[model samples]
Target: MRNDEVLVKVEGVSKKFCKSLKRSLWYGAGDISRSVLGLKNPEKLRKDEFWAVKDVSFEVRRGECLGLIGHNGAGKSTLLKMLNGLIRPDEGRIEMKGKVGALIELGAGFNPVLTGRENVYNNGAVLGFSKAEIDRKFDEIVAFAEMEEFIDTPVQNYSSGMKVRLGFAVASQMEPDVLIIDEVLAVGDLGFKIKCFNEIYRLIENAAVILVSHSMPQVAQVCRTGLVLKQGKINFGPGKVSNAIINYFGIFENNGLNIEGNRRGEIRNFKFGNNDTSVELDISKNQNQPEIILENCQNVFFETSVIIEPSVENFSLIISITDIDQKVVAQVTPPERMFTNLTKMMVVEAKVNSLMLNTGNYSISVHIYNKSNAVDRGEILIGIRNILKFTVKKQKFVGAAPILYESRWKEC
Candidate 1:
């Protein structure tokens, strides 16, 4: 086959399931009878039935990878199962060319009673490999999985990580024409995951790859294209991976404020923005977190009023900016000397000369820490997470870095 050949083509594919097992069995029997009588099954959903995947269409060519991403039960697994030929689509056609390898579930193809060594050969044979072919790659698979010691042990006794290691090693080593990997890699240790990704990078150069992961970074790193599923339908992109990730984050936005800290202090009011735009957060009136939208490198400011207990003397205010994944991307803290005076109620203000975050969704976390010394931010008097969210619009450079620094270039 040519390198640019389309290895996987899914056209208007959809799958549905009945909510009740009895209903599902009944539906299955009826469908089977209809098929035997040269009749077509109903395309529309019947009672107690819902679409798991609906009218999804995309094609993957050799030397390309497609990232399928969504929240749990968004039909990602059902779509993958259909692609792997483990299940049939109810409403659409799927065409896959050449050999296909899938690691859809943890230890999916593994035999519980069989030793790791035996299962390796069994999987290889299932992939159309002969005994001698499996023997040639046997040691490499063991080494890659780092399961040399446990190769003779029954798979049923293996840990989750061990099973994942062996399963990935076999699937990847066989070098099938089309490879489908689900989130099973999450079970492996960090070091092993890194090795597996390196192997995947190599594999995608010659094979069509379909990756399903909730980890946006992993999907961005591996897939050239992406598709986001929401409630059994396409929410965004069979296009750029970045946009798909953005849409995926957008789906879960407006999650209300989360606060964690001692009861010594309470935030009365909070607001942030510049002259052109501003957002005030009202916990009483609005249950959803408010969002601030700004262009890259814009100046922004924050102000908050807090009421403290009589026992509170010296304290420092901490502002943290976190990404969609709730990972701290930036933090701001006032100097210790700034809190010299003691007061029961106070208003605090902070300014950012230039906000350099890349285009993405982010949230602010406000923390009031007790300050005893110059170095120690002793303990949290009050901490409010997801106080409000924000988004930095796309700029000239759309790299993955959380913070985008402006740099000047000189050509020699």
Candidate 2:
């Protein structure tokens, strides 16, 4: 809470894990034995052990947010656990300057048998607040979580989304000097996510935060500094999280095209273009780019060019719009088209009339399906996830199901 404090400092940190569960347990026993005996080479890896995090280091000062991003098993979760003190780094040092609040795993510290309200108080107390202090902020936390009706329910009966809401509510409202949140934001609905983000923005005024999310836009929205971990090493340094995002997505080799893997066709190019307007998207950039902002209630033009070889006969384009939280907004695509040509370039276009989505960034995935002659069924050939992305803004807070449906006044 002091001015210009260094809330978290990680130095040459590394952690290792065993591939097999039984070996992992054995490794843990060996580690404890070595520690008790003050043995040397304790950090050395065993035959079954692999480095989850290796020589990674970073510092977060007051009023700063650090972003951690990588593919699954790239040591993101391991680094977060080390930062939260849930797991110790096999080597190097981690220093915490003040009270730390971490929302690491989903419902990590909650007592399943206790009621949600009771868990709130318990968490608040653990964060160093008195009973009277928790009492003063309890209503605000419950209201922010929108769990007023279910606050008294046992956590065992609560859904995963409910647990996320309550966990985020308590952590964000606890006023910790250091805040660390993993990918828990994906569980809550859009409304709660927006509220949670607002709270994070407010909390960073005098605190330091570390956030990890697969969605680049979400990380760019909250954090100014970033790190890209690749195979247990820090591939990118802090500062300019946008560049870090490009680097993370750029890891998709072969020009970001999935042509070889079990597929009936190849996506030559995917872009957003409107013939009537000058709004043309260069597909070479990262998905959900900053240059593709569009106004709501306007037509969204999408074009995907595909090439199918002789083996596969018929195919169609199935495009899906997914928001930053990885929620499927709509499977908006062009009318069905059956093409029988082989090694021919075919362009598929979709015109979404009056885009009803609320203000946020969305990614478009191009999925090609082929009707297999052997099975007489439509099988997914090639799926290019998050091929393109765009931002939408200048809208009020609306409920889920972003599209606006056609309506007319009728007598009931």
Candidate 3:
């Protein structure tokens, strides 16, 4: 098929499962009997049955990669299994054009007793390759997996990472017209994961790819379009990957301010804002964490007052910014000299000029540390994680970087 051709198409597909295993077996037998008798099975949910994937529809062209993202148990894997033909949807139709390669689960198609070399050929044959074709691609697959020395080992003996490397190598090297990858890549080491992403980029040039992952960065890096599933239904997209990522993060509620440290200090008041906006907190109400919205390149300022015990002599204030994954993206630390004078009560403030974070949700963490103890050591007098949350909005979604630096450009 041509590059623009639609290789995978789904129309309102839905799948349901029974919660009880015994009931599930009974229902399966009844469905089989009805099928043999040429009677249509019921479409509605029965007792203890629930839809795993509901009314999902989308199409993938030959040169496109669709990022399917969601929280755990959001039916992402169920939809992928349906698309890969491992299972059938109960309610809709699916059309897949050409050879479909999948690494949906670790060691999914391999026989544990078989050697890696034997399983490679077995998988190639399952993908409709003949002996000659498998022979031509065999060496390349082994080298890509870096399993040349372990090719003769049984797959059961291979580590999880080894299985992931071998499985990804076979699925990608075959050059199938459609590739479906689940979260199996998370098992491999970072180096191999990078190699897999590079291969995925090359594959999507002429093939239709469907990637299901919880890693938003991975989805943003490789996918042109995205779909977010929530509770077996579409929560967002068949739209921009960035918006889908934002919607995915929106599924979880933000945590309240969590303070941890020695009792030497207590935060009395905290507030923050940008040049165009400011937020004041009322700690007496015991309210949920406050959220602030800011435009791109806005200046951010934060101020807090802390009451220290008499024994505490000097302390330094540290502010850290974290993304939705709770990964620290940016941090601000003042010079130690700023806190030399001893005081029982003090107000500290910090400012960030022209904040350049990408469009996403971020949280602030405040730390008060004794100046004499090293920052690396556990010398925190007081610390609050998720003390405040903020979102940066932009007109257009740029590439997924924690910081979108405004670099000066010139032609030489």
Where's the lowest-lDDT run of ten residues in candidate 3? 370-379
lDDT tens string, model 3, 196-276?
Answer: 999999999989999998887788789999999999999998998878877887787554557789868888778888778
The reply for model 2, stretches above 4 Å from the true place, is: 1-3, 255-412
Candidates ranked by TM-score, best first? Answer: 3, 1, 2
- What C-alpha lDDT values do all the predictions have? 0.88, 0.80, 0.88
Query: In order, how many clashes per candidate?
Result: 0, 1, 0
Q: What tens-digit string does per-residue lDDT give for candidate 2 at 250-305? A: 66534353332466667766767344342443443533443567665466677877
Clashing pairs in 3: none
TM-score of 2: 0.66
TM-score of each: 0.87, 0.66, 0.89
1 against 2, candidate with superior TM-score: 1
lDDT tens digits by residue: candidate 1, 1-412: 6889999999999999999999999999999999999999997789999999999999999999999999999999999999988899999899999888899999898999999999999999998889999999999999998999999999999999999999999989988999999998998999999999999999998999999998988998899999999999999879999888888988986655577888688888888888778988865465666567887445689898887777877777989999877789998768657473356558899988887888888888999877746667778888888888887787566777998887899999
Selected candidate, larger TM-score, 2 vs 3:
3
- Candidate 1: which stretches are off by over 4 Å? 1-3, 262-264, 274-284, 287-293, 296-300, 338-345, 353-356, 370-381, 393-395, 404-412
